[model samples]
Target chain A: MAQQTLEVLQSTDLKPKPDSSELAFGKYFTDHMFMMDYAADKGWQRPRIVPYQPLTMDPSAMVFHYGQTVFEGLKAYRMSDGDIRLFRPEENFKRMNHSSERLSIPPIDEDLMLDYLKELVKLEKEWIPTEPGTSLYIRPMIISTEESLNVAPSNTYTFMIILSPVGSFYKEGINPVGIFVEDEYTRAAPGGTGNAKTAGNYCAAYKAQERATANNKAQVLWLDAIEKKYIEEVGSMNVFFKIDGEIHTPVLNGSILEGITRKSVIELLEHLEMPVQERQISMDEVIAAHEAGTLQEVFGTGTAAVISPVGSLQYKDQDYVVNNGKMGETAKQLYETLIGIQTGRLKDPFGWTVMLEA
Target chain B: MAQQTLEVLQSTDLKPKPDSSELAFGKYFTDHMFMMDYAADKGWQRPRIVPYQPLTMDPSAMVFHYGQTVFEGLKAYRMSDGDIRLFRPEENFKRMNHSSERLSIPPIDEDLMLDYLKELVKLEKEWIPTEPGTSLYIRPMIISTEESLNVAPSNTYTFMIILSPVGSFYKEGINPVGIFVEDEYTRAAPGGTGNAKTAGNYCAAYKAQERATANNKAQVLWLDAIEKKYIEEVGSMNVFFKIDGEIHTPVLNGSILEGITRKSVIELLEHLEMPVQERQISMDEVIAAHEAGTLQEVFGTGTAAVISPVGSLQYKDQDYVVNNGKMGETAKQLYETLIGIQTGRLKDPFGWTVMLEA
Candidate 1:
């Protein structure tokens, strides 16, 4: 790989980092960030690492009104050997390009972007927390920066990556949480921005998520927009179900996010010689499986939470408990394996982990 | 209305305005703009009119990631007597409040907001374009300001109003245009942010807009997301069709914006003793009407385009020409009356125009 030189402006007065034990998801960030600019005439230019600070833009920036923005979430793990490593960082860049294309944004050179990311992470390696499930969460995003309020694609863009020291998703680690099935509010419709990890899709689900939280559920389980029958995702993660000892998930439809963690889970299952299949699992099928006592487990997979077990599902005024409102065996096993591989505690059988040298 | 004192930050250096003939939509802005802020603890703060400049925000602002933003568009017309007036300015603020609730953003006091708007408009009255078919476009928007990447409501918000001197919708004025029916891509579904004039809805329509432009059409005609048969909107406007001596537009569903211009058109139709019905009009029915030589006119109504006549429609390789691919009598009459009332050229009977004394 050709070495890309990124100009670094280190923060002379670094702010105190948050205590690892009290870290929340996406609340505390490191001292430096990666930023690059794009213009239609000049393409991408001036890639640099700068102090984590505020950005100023014309009040009439297109992103403020058009929502033409896409983002990716990944993490940097502090391995047992005291070296910072990343899990399938390339996948995030690849998916970022996919999202950029869908949002009519200019593409980023993946190799160069990965190099820039590694450089930033290496400089801020002190922020990665290795206590229990704590790690450094990496958020890379792009937004339209044209200083006008028109409906067309932006001629200027800003690609930025910021680091946040995030705690484990579950305080107790791999604990079960309840999810409310969202029937009234659909997540993504086909031929829409559903497959892309854009900002609008997340905004559209907030009301449903709020209602779910009001109903004492931890997350919202989204149904397909057209029919509202098929299960699409849970909150922002890909969902999988274990029914009668067989693992199943919704196939790669055009209206659901192709999550990296979801793919790794399927690959890990296949590697372990477990029974797994990808198909359309309708809500009716889920309910039927629950009634027949064959629904052994339901879990969500994402970069933030490797595996979040579903203890119960609330749908249409009916509550269906999965494994009696307790965590499942498969979920616990998968979580351990995923994080173990990520932190380099276990062997990298799938070659998924990328190690960064000090 | 309670009078509110707004802090003003006047710009010392004012850029030269663009030529009226060469002015484009949302390109050049005025010297000063209106702004206000909101926080969960403090609620809405006192409004301000600051110099038109860039806004500084943390890169991790919630709007960049979750897209929790809403905006409204209206216009100010300089009357024949040189008096500046707004066309239902209060309605925009009222509708904005509704949009704010739908997106889980905080609401502004409509009366105080109106006062602030009038005060700002009064200060920048020189930017209001007075030429025929041209007016000053007013855009009021609210965006999340919290610098966090969580998928929740932002605790802080920035509400700003910017003005752009725009040229006429058509250089020739009230010309007919063709629209391509979008069958594959969907706009908004039920229980989505369609009825609200939010940022995401507009962004979701961009790809379809690009495809329509590529197809050599002026705009895209959206079909309902569920069935993809019922006509939803034309571009970002409410669609109305004249068939068999009656006017028909899609009824207000949960997934279609309640256009202010649409409401006025319906009221104006009633005042003129025309039979108008707000009901679902399927594409099949439209095709049959065109084949029967009864589809007299098709037009779209919005704040930007008062009335856009539909010359023809391209759907599924079939072309249905409306009014022989020419502007019809009803559309011409509606356009004339709408602009006439807006500019005080015709008598106002509905109390729709808000007069601002210079």
Candidate 2:
């Protein structure tokens, strides 16, 4: 393992930061950011925490032209004991590196990167919200910095982590939202980068999501590309369905993201003695089950929201309301259990929480 | 028709730039760039030509994270009589807006955008190269600029065009180069963004291209994602084969880009009274044709290279050298005819060339 020497620099002129309650997602940034450089000869260099500033990248930077970038999102929470904690950050770290590998980016020492993250969290512990349902969101991104039009993995790269004080992900709290099933376009393919947390996958879905929003839907649901019959994902989150008294999700078909929150939901469901299965569930099946009165519930899971209960689905000018257009019992239970464990209200049997020093 | 209101900002520090012969691809840029903004309320603003400088974009810009960006590349050439001309520029403009529509980006007025491009080119006439195989490359790009994390098209967007002085596309000149037949990863898929000139499509092919270069190949020969047996593209360019006295290229499937140059090549071949067919050509059939001495020639085409002849194809540890590892007669003829028309050596039969005031 290579030792990382962190260079620290404090901001000279800091603005009067916004209050935690007034904070919006990814809007207000922290004073300092963690950064590191990668090169062919040096592998990965020492990390640094410096004052936040605009990047001086060349116009021909590969990231600007080729979209050779990947990022991860997580949060730091302030516990009742005045200590900061992170929920399964290692999982995020591992998944990020996996995404990097798919984009042909150089891998980093997860332990060293985690240590640097912890140090940043410690230094900016004040940014962590003390209010309920708020925390400091951390964005770790890697971009190609090489100044060339050549379509190749950059010889030089920058990995940086920025912190943002954020409030609730959904403006309407945990109320069920409407989603439209995307028909014309597909997000990822069987052998595509859909499974990886790359920027391209999200960007590809932006247009369809916009159309859905214009049609009065909150999110867009994606189906498999081959047949466009099987359910894939819901934009940024993995979807779950309760059918015939059982919890089920679309299988990891190399085209659906293996969301961290999705995994946690499965574990929580299994712990609660609920039957769960991951399989190729089609749209026809979902519609048939809804009409047969066995659909029970529908929801999505991601780090942004512990669980997003989906109230209705719109497809081809037709609307299907789930469970009377309200949040279901299973979704409510899952959200509360996950949020309780995250906020230290419930005991964590999986050792998924990591407490930080004040 | 939307009247174009050009806002001109005269640059103060315009340098006496270097001559075209010493130009490197995408290195030296023009003094001015054309920009326009798009919003939901205001569809697209009037275009403006301002002094080129680094844009002050928010750190959470969609282009910087989710890769919500698309770009088009074409060039302005200096004719013998000191007049500037654009080769099939309408095709490039039409295709760019098509890409925008598919990516859910707001489309620009093609006529106004063209007028703005012409005005910008007129101002930067000195940047156009007079040397052979050299010209001023124009890059028009659109990016989402909303400083939010929601997976949707930005309510605001920035459309900009920058010019770069470039030499020949190939570093060592266009000699017959070896191509690796890639059977593993794919660049795009059916019902995907492959048809759009999006950044993600190029980035996805980078790793495989790098591996091909590492193995002493100039490019990777892309196969269809399903079964991986049929020829699709050469990744960056569209592939063409001369078998049994006829020209053959892959039909534009949803998984492959419909290159402007590819269309031109097909047109040129037909104009030359040669038989051409756009159909699926399998790898086994290609090998059989090669072994039976029916494979007359093989080449790839794009705006960057015009035409790049293939020396050999490496597939599964086997090498199949085309035409004794040299450029074929058919490939040479096509290259000469295409280059002749672009450089004004041949008659403009299709009125494809648009001359600009120098």
Candidate 3:
């Protein structure tokens, strides 16, 4: 394999970085962004970190017409000792490759991409916020660039990585949120692109999300596309339930996104000696558990918010409040432990966090 | 809604027009293309026909991240009397509005938009091919343009129309083509955006299409997402079958695209006093009908091909040839009648063709 070299071109104009407390998710981008291009004739080449700016392309580009695009999200936390840290960043790129295969995009070398990400973080290290729950959110995405209206796999693509300093997901403190079970719009189905982090899956979700928001809820709880009885996911995140002193979540079904945070939560629960099992748990079972007073806690896992406790769930105009609409002990413990591990504050027992040299 | 003003910026340099014999589908565009912009504060505005060129946008545009885009396709034909005509152009714009609503894009005034399209086709009248089956392909698309990575409905959008002079779908003559039944991948679910002409639906289909192409088939015959048994569509077109003397097509299920051509085919068949039915048709039933010698013909209907006869179907590596791999009489008559109506070669019985004043 030919080694690709990075050509860096720093920005001449640099704006003052936002204070960590005021950083908003996906807003206030860094000065530089990583970019690369791929074509049928030329493989992935010209890897570079250029000034963050708009891109120019033909309006008839295939990405706009057909939308063969996939994306990944991760974060870089500023360690207490001033070293930047990444929590299992390799897993994200691995899953990104899985998404690439599903979307028919070219596979990226994980080591090379990780090195590029570390280089980007090193160059924009100052953008890594120091405050609690604050980190530099990294977005790696691939978009078809072939300017053809023909409905086929794109021969050309653009791989880009942009950074954003994010504020705390919980402004005051970790609190429980309300979820509305969605029945109108199905996010994905079996033998679909649900497992892949593709743009369409996210696009299909907005309608359900809008409905949830309109009803004063935080997010939509997606049911299985086939039966619409089984629980699949909560918004873009993976869902987990603590019922009768056992931790349960839907298995790695083809229609549910394989969330890295969800995996970590399961591992953390097992490590804490709490019984954890990945199984098909239906909404009816959840409702029955709630009625039987065995539904102890409900939470969602993702890179953005880590673990968000669900205080209540609304299904067909009926509200199922969990644990008196409060965060349970297990939810609190998992949040703190996972957050601590991610920020390099907790002891490294599983070697999940990789520390970067300052 | 306030009437939007039309702005025109004519292209200074015009390329030599391609010969009708050498035209290719979706290849070689006209000198000018229509463009429009929409924002939350200012609605859809500044409709213009500018020089065909590339568009510049931020890499963080929502369309790249969320795939919130929809499109419509139609054609304008050059008559034998040196006049230009459009078939159901208003219907295309009305369907575009349907797509826009499904995609959370602001609705476009169908009448005003139809006027702009008429103006565009009138300006590009010379580009309309005069060949037997060739016409100027019209593509109208709306894409989210908001520069945010957040997964939500875009506050800004761009709607544009581009015209393409095309070759005939059948170079020599309309003939039958083979289809591969897609049992592995599901195109769209019941509650998904299957009916909407969205980018994601097309993107999700390319894999199945590629598989069919690899197996020497012309297109993929999609099945219902849930059971994977009932017929939905055949590769971006509506599927139709002729059993004995009656015509049958899949009902307008939420997962089946409501093709305008399909609607026209039913109306034309009813006008000809042929019995037609729209209901659930399964693969097993089709195979049973074939074995029982009741399956007479299979065809697909769309704006591009008008009526395409399916000569063969491959299911589980088994090929089922229809009408001994020959075009059926019904398929032939429908194809010729539809083409004649579209190209201004036949009498206007349904008033489907709208002739533009040049």
Strongest candidate by DockQ: 1
What's model 2's lDDT at B231?
A: 94
Instruction: State candidate 2's TM-score.
Output: 0.93
Kindly list the per-residue Cα lDDT of model 1 for residues A85-197, writing each as its tens digit. Answer: 79999999999999988888999999899989999999999899988788999999999999887788899999999999998777875568899998998778887889999
Fnat values, candidates in order: 0.70, 0.49, 0.63
> Which digits, one per residue and each the tens of the lDDT, describe model 3 over residues A1-358?
2677899999999979987767777878899999999988888999999999888878778898888998999999996679889989999999999988878888988889998899899999988988888999999999999876777889999999999998999988887999999987999988789999988888788778889999889999999998999999999899999999888999988989999999898888888788678999899999999999999999999999998999999998999999988998988898899998888888869888988887
Which one wins by TM-score: 2 or 3? Answer: 3
The two-chain DockQ for each candidate, comma-separated, is 0.76, 0.55, 0.74
Score residue B1 of candidate 1 by CA lDDT. Answer: 20
**Order of candidates by TM-score, top first?**
3, 1, 2
Q: After superposition, how far is residue A297 of candidate 3 from its true place, in Å?
A: 0.2
What would you estimate as the lDDT of candidate 1? 0.90
Q: Name the regions of candidate 3 deviating beyond 4 angstroms.
A: none
TM-score of 3: 0.98
